[model samples]
Target chain A: MRKITAALLITGLVSAGFAAKEEKKENLFEKKLMQDIKVLNEKIENLYKLHVKECAPEYIAKAEAYLDAIDGMSYINPDTGQIERTEISPMDKIIFENKARKYLAIAKEKVYSDADGDGIPCYQEIEQGTNPFEAEKKVSRAETEMKEQKVSEKPEVKKVGYQPLKMHARIHFDFDKYNIKKDYLPYLNVITRYLKAHDNLKIKIVGYTDSIGSKEYNDRLARKRAEAIKKYLIDHGISPDRIEIIGKGKEDYLFDNNTPLNRFTNRRAEFFVMEPTESQ
Target chain B: MRLLTAVIFSIFLTAGSYAETTTTELLDEAQNSIKAAFESGCPTYAPYEYYKAETYYRIAREETSKLNTKAGDAAAIKAIEWALKAMAKRYGEE
Candidate 1:
């Protein structure tokens, strides 16, 4: 009887050991399955959020379906008789995600089509009430072309000109002399042609001098320079009443008068073209 | 031995977190680049290149959100490259 009791006790201990081992295996499987589900849930949520941000309702629905499929399926490992993962394998999940990506790409292409190869999308063009089939000119370009066409379509006036041609002619002088050099006659000739072409325009001849001379002396020199230019214009057939003369003695220097070259630049005669006022 | 195992586990966790942070940084940079290109009239001057850059930027954002760091990094790099190309085209550069 004592031997029988000992054998039974040994059998009970062995059975308990096996049960403990099985329980540990089952816990490991359950832990792995839970971890996988958590990861999958996060991925599904991420996909849903992405579609929402993209404004893709169909993709949102697909993400929901994937989540439902995962939740409804089991992950039992047949060999171990334990739950190890979800029904969807890693490869299958990748394929499913790739399908979503492909759908998104196709949707984007359809929505953002630029049929005319314009930088603007077709949907944007339609929103702007423009033809999507053809490239539309930018607002600034359209405005400029319209303005040019309007100007071109206006009738040409005969006597009363609305716009005046403004021009400037310069004649450089010798260091201190007020005499007009022959070298500047070509420039004056161009101005003469312009004045003749536009008879309604008036010319103002202004003279300037370098800073070397006294203000009074330079002023007289500048006056003489203007007078010489006026004499040349009168000799060239321009009306004296159409010209006005002024002398600005070293007042407005074109450059700093520290160097001889800069002083030479300051000693120049300038012509101003005045436009007629509306009252005139 | 337990302390050694704990240190190694913590190091691995830190590395994994660092990878995630890197992906987020890459995505942010790609977004900034794409925004700059668009603001410079790249969409108007270089439509095709701008579109390509935008597509890559979108993919990068999506992959980063999905925690697919490897794919996200590649897409982010592509996004910046295409964005630079768009900018070059907009400025009339080859």
Candidate 2:
């Protein structure tokens, strides 16, 4: 009699286990949506590894959306008065679909014109009317005219290189400080000019510090510096995350750290050329 | 039968609680790492600061496993908060 009772109990337990997983099993869309989020996250992570820092913000935003969607899908089981998944709720499906569409739109824009879809969205096929990519052709012509004017006006100096992306002065800071010393902020005007001109290319205000203290401490200070720069950029109208923070502790320095002056040189941060990739 | 149900429920709750604790701990560690990076690179933000922040953010996010019941939500939220805080401190007040 005890043996029979044990077998019956085992079967009941197994059934309960199945019941627990049943909702997840039935929800095909939810499963696929979750998979998509993971795939997107992986793609972004891989690109960052390749030193493609400029494209990271858009990807990060997408990843955040995916996480939010997953969390929003929790369902309540009416019968048990407890929460249980019943496939995906309609609300959850709509949220995911909308977000997916937005991401796809961004991906499509990458192939044609700018990443932000500014001014023109994309260059449409001739048969499809106005091409967004074609807008660049006008920009190129204008740039050539401006260059010619500058050359003719100066008739000296000599122009060279593949049309410089416009240079800007990157401000460096002292250890653990965020104030834009009255002297440093002026140089940022150079950055402002570049932004005003290109309006497309972005800047990454990376922060750095020397390797003096514990590995963890320097890292935190470096982040503070980067954040200070990022906030500055946003105030100047650049989008957040467009300006990235990179903190380097004593590990990577341009000059030797033995002397105070050399250490000072090592304790500086610089701006990087942040042009959009052709891959968008 | 009631005992078995209780056991399963207890296991789920315990797992959830454990996951929550780890997420918080990882975030604390990451915050410290960011702080260390800053002090080490003193006088200016160095290149490695970015690498450290990236690593911390990535690890915190990765900790969100399938077993991470809430589907990594808590971890992701906490990580992002630290990332922004780190950014503010590095960059400037807007």
Candidate 3:
């Protein structure tokens, strides 16, 4: 009975010793994992500090989460009592780094790639409804300045009511001659001054005749008188295109051609200033 | 107590009068500046600056109409600033 009791005590002691040894081995593995986690945390903190300016806050937080996942991940080999790193894979690390790189690339683009060189980023220019590639097309300070000068240089010309100048001097001609008389020269000078001042004026010269000859002969004489006036105006620097001549030839007489005075009044050339059309 | 109430009412009336005067002055100055800028070709040349000035001036007018004197004064000052900026741009200054 004593020997059996001694054997039981020995077995109990051996069992306790084995349990303690196992606990020690487990503690060592846990200690190693804690150390690895600390190291990983430090590395993550360093990376975050280094790229805080370039990387966005969200990406940094995601990176930290990935580091945590890596740190918490471990697999135990039952046969060899070994811990395997199975938390974050190499591909996961690569993905995190790539994401960080993408953020950095975006930061670089914002800092350096100003397509218009208008002191505004391309993304901001797009938001402002301005051209990103063409610097001049955008509403830049320099372009605004140039536009200001152009606006000041050209004053707007307003169109008031159109009032055409009328030549009050009636052009009288000799009874038998188509030549313009000396008295009409002053009227022609006035017309020339007005035409020179306003290059836009157009004129109509109408010639009339008294009832003294055949209708055909009167028509020819009236035409010659109108042509004489037109030739005078063209010779005095007025454009030929601006003048239109017509011969009434004893039709629509202003005065009765019965007496010499009435005949003189009837046989005359009238100058009418034409108003500029609205389209002109 | 009645005397105190009358005094407080008078004070309120005076303050309201002062605020109205200040807002009116600010709005007048703003309008004058905007008119000058427009006449200087700000609308055609410095369109963006002119737009900003006009927007601020409109806001100032609206606020003044609503009797929001403080906001109206602030908006009027901003209007003047933008109008001057438009004029500067019109004169070929950056």
Specify the highest-lDDT model's number. Answer: 1
Candidate 3 lDDT by residue in tens digits, A252-272: 554445433345656778777
Model 3's CAPRI class?
incorrect
Q: Please give each candidate's TM-score.
A: 0.31, 0.30, 0.31
How much of the real interface does each model capture, measured as fnat? 0.00, 0.00, 0.00
lDDT of 2: 0.51
lDDT of 1 by residue, A46-159 (tens): 544332312333343343333333333232332355644333444444544455445545544544667667787655544333345445565435744664564455324423
Better of 1 and 2 by lDDT: 1
Q: Candidate 2 lDDT, tens digit per residue, A1-280?
A: 9999999999999999998778766577567776776665665455444322222334334444444444453433223445543223445445545665565345434434443344543322211222232354554457457746754664244232112244534455655565665556755666766666776666655566765667788777777776776677678877664565677655555444543334444555666646654433
Model 3 chain B poorest ten-residue lDDT run = B66-75
How accurate locally is residue A243 in candidate 3, as Cα lDDT from 0 to 100? 85
Consecutive 10-residue window with the lowest summed lDDT within model 1 chain A: A49-58
Comparing 2 and 3 by DockQ, which wins? 2
Candidate 3 TM-score versus the reference: 0.31
Off by over 4 Å in 2: A1-168, B1-94
